[model samples]
Target chain A: MYTDLVAALDIGGTKIAGALVDGHGRILVRAQRPTPARENGDTVMRAVEEVLAELTASPLWGRASGVGIGSAGPVDASAGTVSPVNVPGWRDFPLVARVRAAAGNLPVELIGDGVAITAAEHWQGAARGHDNALCMVVSTGVGGGLVLGGRLHPGPTGNAGHIGHISVDLDGDLCPCGSHGCVERIASGPNIARRALENGWRPGADGDTSAAAVAAAARAGDPVAVASFERAAQALAAGIAATATLVEIDIAVIGGGVGKAGDVLFEPLRKALSTYATLSFVRHLTVAPAQMGTDAGLVGAAAAALAKRTDAAAAGV
Target chain B: MYTDLVAALDIGGTKIAGALVDGHGRILVRAQRPTPARENGDTVMRAVEEVLAELTASPLWGRASGVGIGSAGPVDASAGTVSPVNVPGWRDFPLVARVRAAAGNLPVELIGDGVAITAAEHWQGAARGHDNALCMVVSTGVGGGLVLGGRLHPGPTGNAGHIGHISVDLDGDLCPCGSHGCVERIASGPNIARRALENGWRPGADGDTSAAAVAAAARAGDPVAVASFERAAQALAAGIAATATLVEIDIAVIGGGVGKAGDVLFEPLRKALSTYATLSFVRHLTVAPAQMGTDAGLVGAAAAALAKRTDAAAAGV
Candidate 1:
């Protein structure tokens, strides 16, 4: 089994990524193409096919036992379809069927990209060896997944651990998802920058008004910028504490652009967590920065494929 | 196995209730004793032993296979200890060992009272046959437990679903549990009655200031009383939505004293759920009243014992 491999795809609005990954999570071959996100569904799918063609052309392709796709969601793993918010051209797109066809009729597993990231972290990154954990990405959007009872809990629809959309402030600002005070509304990278600028923080000479710029200003002791990050941390802490209280997670791994704000974000988060996660079972919960890098999607896709393979074999499939 | 019974104990601050439950969840023998909650640890243990002795005196006790205890938590199932907040004298009490000895050394299983209710609900109540659900008791406190992937998720500590203490309002009133705006702080029966009284809703000539009194006043179109129940319903809805968002539970079964307030609570809760459970996967979540009655704890304890017995047999123990 160590000699065998799985073909993996990380499909997002910006790129179609393909790889042949070994059993130990090593990428033996890789291919990528920019997604034609604004075009029709068929056009975007062609880009995915081309990336798959490159992976299939590799000599290691023959050793691939299955294919796994981690896609921008809401993905219906049960229906083998995806309806990513950023990709308007592909609502209810039959991704698993198309990927299976492109990969020579091999078995295919589909999961939301956040769940994929969690799979990576649980297998080889910050959440490794922890039975109950949550791994999150706090970039343009906040997304996450859970590992429960020592296994990835993708739920019936493969979208269980969606912490960002969960309301922490029931009466706060209305979110685009039609919810009030969602964690993403307060803690995402764009929201952090927006809140900072709203409260009178100005960008540097470069005019770079991103969360990274806000992080730099916060480190420099800018009061308004510091306050913005503190608010985001507060919302994140509330959400994380809620998650721990609900499911008894021992650790929460945070990644993406805003998570890299270091102590500027973590300090206030730790303080706020103490205020919210007061339960006996949840008081010991810890927050850590995610260790998986940009390739987490591909690696996690491979892990999903491997798990599916094992499950099928156990069922005599 | 059908002829075998499990001895079940429902330990709380007010009472020590025991029963001999068969495989079909029918109680054949019963025993009860008032809890010596303020007495020393030995007195409380003695009360439990007396209850067990009563059950042992029944002729049916000869066919008992195991014993299960569902105690007010936080229960440490791994360590076989209980530290129920309402029962101070029994902090870290070795209930499992004591019960095992009292029950002729039969194998024992321990779970939190909330988890016990969830097992009963999943097995024979409103949440029956659901693969994933949350069962809650909203009486003096808002305790709850989860069923995930068709199995009771008691977590490692036997206290996975302590929903009462989860903060839904991050900056709201400080809770007695050292948290801010816990669900119990806002939605528990006492809190509901208190909020109504705080807002000038006077009790009747009967001087009954319970949540039930508020429910009656609200039913008679008292605006203040209606508003208080609405506020409690709002907090409960937020907590339930957060649970559904994090774990993908399709149904939330609510029981206990406050739950019996009927349309006064349920109407507002259903409306508020739409404001918080906004995600596609969570939008369809339903709230239903718990079907199991006062005996839920004993039956649920029996379910835990039966499950443990089956697991041990499967392991060839």
Candidate 2:
């Protein structure tokens, strides 16, 4: 069934991404442009329009029925607006209207970047076939979304999966949200590098070693690297396992940049899960890595569009 | 809306309960009998039957069209069987079929007792109007149910909400589930009393002061009692906060025997929540006492019958 394609956009701090996605979670035509960070919301929308125009061609665009944009944090999906904490210019901006204006307003859907990834995972990735699970992006700022009892929670303010803000340690570190000991305070990419630098494990700006490098070094038997990954994993896993005790999902899907630590992260993460979530049933909680890689946001946006179709069909009002 | 009344039964180790409930979440009649633990499953069923028979004299019984049961842990809600860890003679016993047979072919529905309470809370109590929440029983066991995105997760075996088993401290305590540091082992009623007695709080049967007594004494300003409650709250709040971070629910319904500590529990619970859940959003999670109280099981069971009716109507196939 040709349910019409959706132009999925991922608006990041550094990049503007747009993709034409069909109902089956496939990315057809894609466009990428640099994001103008310092510019106001209007300028940002202009850049988004340029990227969309390049993909639409006004011909292929006819085949697409709507637009879906996954933006950064503190979003209000219900209002179709965003108050991104990272992009200072985007305070209560009407991003969905702008994207709709750029794409000729077939229908516009917006979600937290985290929620988009969660939808992507549920639709056709590591979290497939699971109704209750957490889709977590452990990247620049840890965030997540939940598919609980087989439904997505857009939350009252669309901030349901803000995992990075959850504080595991009381006196550990401070986060951008003015919280102390948040997982993001100590486990985000920059935090990992800083921790490494503080411990004399990071080689420096010239080294430019990522969390992935720490994972590699940990694998190579580097004690400090091992310790860094373990510390971050400890915080992340504690939070995850604690959640398992309450929400009781069968699995957790990890994605985003920091998730690339792979086994270095998963192994220790599992160990931590076992340690923190010692419940009989919860001990069996499985941790899986996302399979969709970088295209998750786009695929997830398409899934959002598909969900709208399903909801509308279900209502039949 | 006179869909038919449901005879809902709850069989705990300490109590046997029966209630007649209509589709609108109203309990028309209620009765209780002490559980004869030394007797086998057959004897227990006879006791349950006796209680049900007592309730049948009520006017609502004539309208009762079905039965719903919520049994102790390790139950198979789908199969309507239970082998409660504390109750003997229940090894794979088909509680639903037996209860149905006793009820004379009444449509029988089965759910984890915890899930049953969760259903009740979601329908009429703390979790009402919330799409995602948890129903937790901090009584004889640390049992719970997940109402994620507004659906109850019975798991494959219907034993999904076993929150007490979630390990809060790896080196904390030994649980019957063979895992270390389960919240149950650390914070459940028995453990609370056990630890308090072990710590030389009150002179009595060690583990006998009861979680209730601890709450009372704590409320009355006993240092030992205060400490015990704090420890339990600390563990429980951490678990609750972690769960909020994962599911991002608006409320959690806490019920069962031990939840009566009231502010004694809620105060320390909040303190621990704010301490362990550093994330601003999760730290804002709400906790409420279960509204249905002891009848929550019956209420939830009747809700299940109501759900069955709604489903049958919707299908019309």
Candidate 3:
């Protein structure tokens, strides 16, 4: 059979999205379900099965040679399991095997959502032309992925770029990850909102205390909101510089809610980067907003699937 | 002639060493010269030429197909230039071209000294069996390199794993590299000695104020010295954990002066690593003393040369 398509599943705590993607990374069929995250593992599995059923129902599914999953992680690609912290019922869940069985035994490849996003960015977004780059999602949580030597570097466990948890301030506040002063602790959307509220940045008539609201206030010249975003930018810059120093990335592509803060986040981020990325090799590092939008995870997953198919074919498997 | 040997040059601030090494990593000829680092760039180039001349005098040199140079960096392997921090005479010096010319137009490859050590470690030392590892030199100024997916990851400019400059404390004291709270600023040999001295720890009878002296004091139950080493260990741990979190290294091989401090450094380092390496993928990351000794740089440079030759052969060049 001529297989020119691949199946992709982007599984998160709030949603289970499935799609059949063509060789050109276009989605020909799509399905999604609000995750029953609070339910038992089996119920969550059923939701995934339903999504797969919707995908399998499409005539395009016949062309899918393999399945690729981009799930909220820590994903153990080596072991084919997923233990997403937000998905309480899915600790060490055999996601790959279950998904493979549900999808008529198609070969399955799995990676962390951060790595998947990187694959998307490297394929057709901000990191497209860069051989070494970092792609980040700064929403309620800060997560990231790396591209080294022009390929996605999803380490052995598919979680090589968990930048959020790396400590930038060793003696700073203890993070929920059991680390002190993690980038996510200071730069995530929730953290940005929390810091702003703690520092007397009040919400308007809508009573919205989200980071977006804080960014709005910062845009309007609110000192407290601006300070909070600046602090977040500092942490993000330190983490980004640390990443660039360690792996020699030339660019960092930022996405997600906090990344949408535009100049408020990027200006301070670029300035703080100058403070940390002082080495000769890292001095040229640049930051840009991500181009991949809502369907990044799906497209990234499909990219992984296509890559696996190519690899298998190359190896004559 | 059947080419089975590689010529290696290990260039540092204090010395220039060269060798003709066989495919089995055994050195068949050796040469050395004290670096005229304070002299003009031409004089420094002459010293390197002198070392190469000595190696070329040996009959074993006839079998060498390529020459590898491992210099104190920042080296631009892509541009064939070097601007080592300690060697002020060389600023963007064309070391690769000069060495290639001096070595009878042999194919030449250049990498940082830290990367050379990592190649050595990955080829025959502590990181030999581990596919993903970080090898470091915690000496006067800390430096390091990485092995990813069982091969050396000498990023675009040959300085990927320069972990010493990565910030562990974003707001801490400034480093010579113009960064704040870099690992080298807190965990390097000089920093350890400086911190101990500033904390009112008096040198012993011999008045040795080096990090080795501080390690001796820490071993002898001096509280102040112990605290200094502990602080240095904390910084090293945070940096190591950060490296593991970013690139998924399974092991970190420590060497050089501070790494020789044994339990005084390792004990606190392991304790602090548990504090920062909280992610599942990085939690299993282990720290070990580097197995390659002073000869590491020479061997590692040879390893790079051999690798280059092998690659060329594979590509039918």
**Candidate 2, B198-278: lDDT as tens digits:** 887784455457778777777888888888888888778756765666556667778877788898888888777766665
DockQ computed for model 1 against the true two-chain complex using alpha carbons: 0.78
- On TM-score, the candidate that comes out on top is 3
Fnat of each prediction, in sequence:
0.73, 0.28, 0.81
Which of candidates 1 and 3 is the stronger one according to DockQ? 3
> What TM-score applies to chain A of candidate 2?
0.93
Q: What is candidate 2's lDDT per residue for A28-144, written digit by digit as tens?
A: 898888988788888877888888988778457778877777787667776778877667888889888888777776788887888888988988898888977888898777888
Candidate achieving the largest lDDT: 3
Which ranges in model 3 have alpha carbons more than 4 Å from their true place?
A1-3, B1-3
The candidate that wins on DockQ is 3
| Pick by TM-score: 1 or 2, better one | 1
lDDT for each residue of candidate 3 in A186-271, tens digit (9 for 90 to 100): 99999999999999989999999999999999999999999999999999999999999988999999999999999999999999
Off by over 4 Å in 2: A55-57, A149-153, A163-208, A231-237, A271-284, B29-33, B38-62, B148-157, B168-182, B190-208, B222-224, B256-258, B268-284
Write one digit per residue (lDDT tens) for candidate 1, span B1-317. 22368999999999999999999999999999999999989999999999999999999998899998899999989889999898898778888898898889999999999999999999889999899999999999999999999899999889988888877777789899888888999999999999999999999999999999999999999999999999999899989988888889999999999999999999999999988888778888999999999999999999999988887887899
lDDT of 1 by residue, A1-317 (tens): 23369999999889989899998999989999998989999999999999999999998888999998989988988899998998899988998899899999999999899999999999899999999999999999999999999988888878888889887777789899988888999999999999999999999999999999999999999999999999999899999988888888999999999999999999999998998888778899999999999999999988888988988887899
**Candidate 2 overall lDDT versus native:** 0.76
TM match of model 1 to true structure: 0.97
For residue B193, what is the lDDT in candidate 3? 94
- lDDT string, candidate 3, B8-115, tens digits: 999999999999998888888999999999999999999999999999999877888999888999999889999999899999999988999999999999999999
Give the C-alpha miss distance for residue B38 in model 2, angstroms. Answer: 4.4
